[model samples]
Structure formats: structure tokens, C-alpha cells
Target: MAESLKDKVALVTGAASGIGLATARALIGAGARAVMADRDAAALERLAGELGDAAIPLVTDLLDPDSCAAMIPDALERAGRIDILHCNAGTYIGGDLTETDPAAIDRMLNLNVNAVMKNVHAVIPHMTGRGSGDIIVTCSVAGHFPVPWEPVYSGSKWAITCFVQTMRRQLNKKGIRVGQVSPGPVISALLADWPEENLRKAKESGSLIEPEEISDAILYMLTRPRNVTIRDMIVLPTNFDI
Candidate 1:
């Protein structure tokens, strides 16, 4: 019964490192062969080596429509049907509404929101044709609660949250399951560039949440019985009040 994932195919985005990497690891552990996509080519190669041949690494630029188009067919050709998709690619830019550069906002939206839409758009035809698949989106706590300093980031995440929620409602009857996982701040490469003050504050507030924490949540959603759809899950650091 647990072998439900065995031999199944999964595609994960932003999978060179951090949360995406951890999720890929978990999926592979559960017996699903996976395609890991990311823009970081060198890192992708290293990860593919570590995971061996069961993990296929595809270099991708999520901001490019053509790149998005190219990835799906390649994965399908190599892995056959895509039984699961983990849309985990995202970007964060910090600035108040007035201080934020318009270009930065555009990049954030295009990378964090539009890219996700493009991937789903490209893959949905196949999923719908099969009449079954799982779409797992990596949303964030900031999606549910506004992070004032980073309005655009919040807005982008909120959009993803709403998209998956509504998609879940529409696809539930068609054997397609949409699941959203919202993560609070976690230790990742993104955190390496954090301002010292903010880093200190995060640590002072609580222990850093690891990528494995979020990965475990994703694994749970993917492994549930066919009839059981875990629609949404929010993972917050123990110290975060929200």
C-alpha cells in the first residue's frame, strides 16, 4: 500500500538547494523517481551526482517562458507521466512600497508568481489528460500575514496561496489534488544574505527551522491515501508567535 509512490514520477522546482532540495530528497526516499529543476546549474550537477541517476537535474530559468516550456517535455520524455509537481521556486525582495524599485517588484512577481503559473499551465494539460496528479505549492506564512516591509513579496505569496486553494476546489472531483504548504522563516541560502540585525532577531525569537521540517510536510501530503487530500499545511518556527 505504501508503495503508492514507487515508480511514480515527480518534478520539483528550485531544487538545487534549501527547501526544494530537501523536498526532493524526501520524495526520492519515498520511492518516486524525480526531476529536479533550477537555474543553478553547477549546484544542480552536484546534487544530481549525490542523488545518483534516480534524480534528473534540469537547469531552468523560471523567468523565461521558453525555458518553462522546454522543461516539461524533457521531464515527460525521461520520466514519463508527471504524477506529482512541487512548485517550490520563489524569490524575496525587501522594501517598503515607496522604497521598492519597480523592477524589483516585477522580478519578484515574475519569478515567484508568474513562473509558478507558467509551470502549472505547461503541466496541467498532461495532468488533466491523465485525470489525476498532485500539485504542491510552496507558499509562505507571509502569504497569510502581511510582512509590511516586503509588501510585494507578501502579495506574490498570497497570490500563490489563493491560486492553489481555488485550484484544489476545482480539481478535487477530477482526481487532481492541490496542496499548499506555507513555511515560516527557515535556514536556507536565502538566509545567508539576511541583514545581521534581522538574522539576530530571527535567532533570538526561536531556533531556526530546517528544510527537513518543510520537506516532511510535503512528503506527508504526497503519501496520503488517494481519497485523502491534505489541502493546506502551515509550518511555523516554534518561536514565531503567528
Candidate 2:
């Protein structure tokens, strides 16, 4: 069954590190080439090198309109075609809403929400023309329930959850599957904003999950039968509350 995915091309954003990196590796291990896109050119190049020819590096900042707009084309040029698009690049902003900077909110929203939508919109034509494709977004458990400490971040994910569902409805008829993998307190750079004490506590309590877990879920989503679609998969550690 896994061999059925051989030779497929998966374009993964934020592919330099964290969940994106894990997902890229998973795809490559499954015999698919990975188009790894990220702003961290050094990290991306290094990681791509580690993956050899199966990893195609596309260095572009998702926060930059021009760069983000050109990412799909650049990937197509480098990898030929994209059979899967994983919109997993994002930022996090936590704490009091009154204390959060307006500029920071815009940056987070632009990267977390707008960039995801643009990438999806830009790739629609290519997928439709092919009559088959898979799109998965990295949402959060906070998207399903309000997390007081991360109002802005939660709101961004909430927007994404709705977008993925609606997009799935429209894309399903076109032979394209749209879905989201919502994870809780993943061990990633996204937690850099968390208080050190809380982070330590979560780790001790086994509340944090590794990026590979999320990648595994995404791989399962991709390898499902053509008529099967795991629309919204919520993956979390056993100790995670949400």
C-alpha cells in the first residue's frame, strides 16, 4: 500500500525544522520526493542535503507576499509537480491580549492564516488539472477550544479549521482532498513563547508530543484509499487536556 505513493511529490512549508521537517522526511521515506520550502535558507539547504536528491529546497519567506506568491511556481520548477501540499508553517503569540503588539498580531495572522490560504488558492489549478491531490493544514487543539493564554494564536487556528472544512467541501468534488491535523502542545519552536516553567511541567507530565507523531498522522491521511478522507485528525499526547 505504501508503495502506491512512490514517485509522488509533496511540497512542505516550514520544511527546515520541527513538524515540517519530520513530515518531509516521512514523505521521502515513503518513496516520495519532498519540495521543502522555508525562509531559513541555511537550515533548509542543510536539511535538503541530508535528504539527498529526494529533498528539493525552495527558500522563500511565507511572510513576504512576493516570495510566498512565487513559492508554488518555484516548487513546480524544481520538483516538476506537487501531489501533496502541507501548509504547516506558522508562528505563535501568547499571553495577555492587551500586551500583545498589533504588529505582531499582523505578522502572525499573515503567516498563519493568509499565507496558508494563498498557497491553497495558488495550487488549486494544478491539482484540479491533474484530477487528484491532497492538502493538509497544521491546525491546533486551541482551534477547537479557546486557550485563554493564547487568544490570538487560537483565533488564527480557529480561522484555519473553518477554512479547511469549507475548502474540503468545495475541493472534494474536484478530486482534491482537503483536511487538517490538529495537535496539542507539540514539542516545536511554536512553544518558544511558552513560559519555561510551564514547558518544563508539560514535558514532565508527558503532555508534549514529538513532531514525528504528527507526521505519522499526516502520512496516514495521505495513504488512505482514494475514496477515504480523514477530514480533521486531532492528535495529542495522552496527558494533554484538550
Candidate lDDT scores, in order, read 0.87, 0.94
lDDT of 2 by residue, 1-242 (tens): 43266999999999999999999999999999999999999998788778999999999899889999999999999888999999999999988899999999999999999999999999999999999999999999989999998899999999999999999999999999999999999888989998677788899999999999999999999999989999999998999865
Q: Judging by lDDT against the true structure, name the best candidate.
A: 2
RMSD of each: 1.5, 1.0
In model 1, state the lDDT of residue 43. Answer: 93
Relative to the true structure, candidate 2 has a C-alpha RMSD (angstroms) of 1.0
Top candidate when judged by TM-score against the true structure: 2
Model 1 over residues 111-130: C-alpha lDDT tens digits?
88888888887888899999
Per-model TM-score on C-alpha atoms:
0.95, 0.98
In candidate 1, which residue ranges exceed 4 Å CA deviation?
Answer: 1-3, 193-195
Model 2 poorest ten-residue lDDT run: 1-10
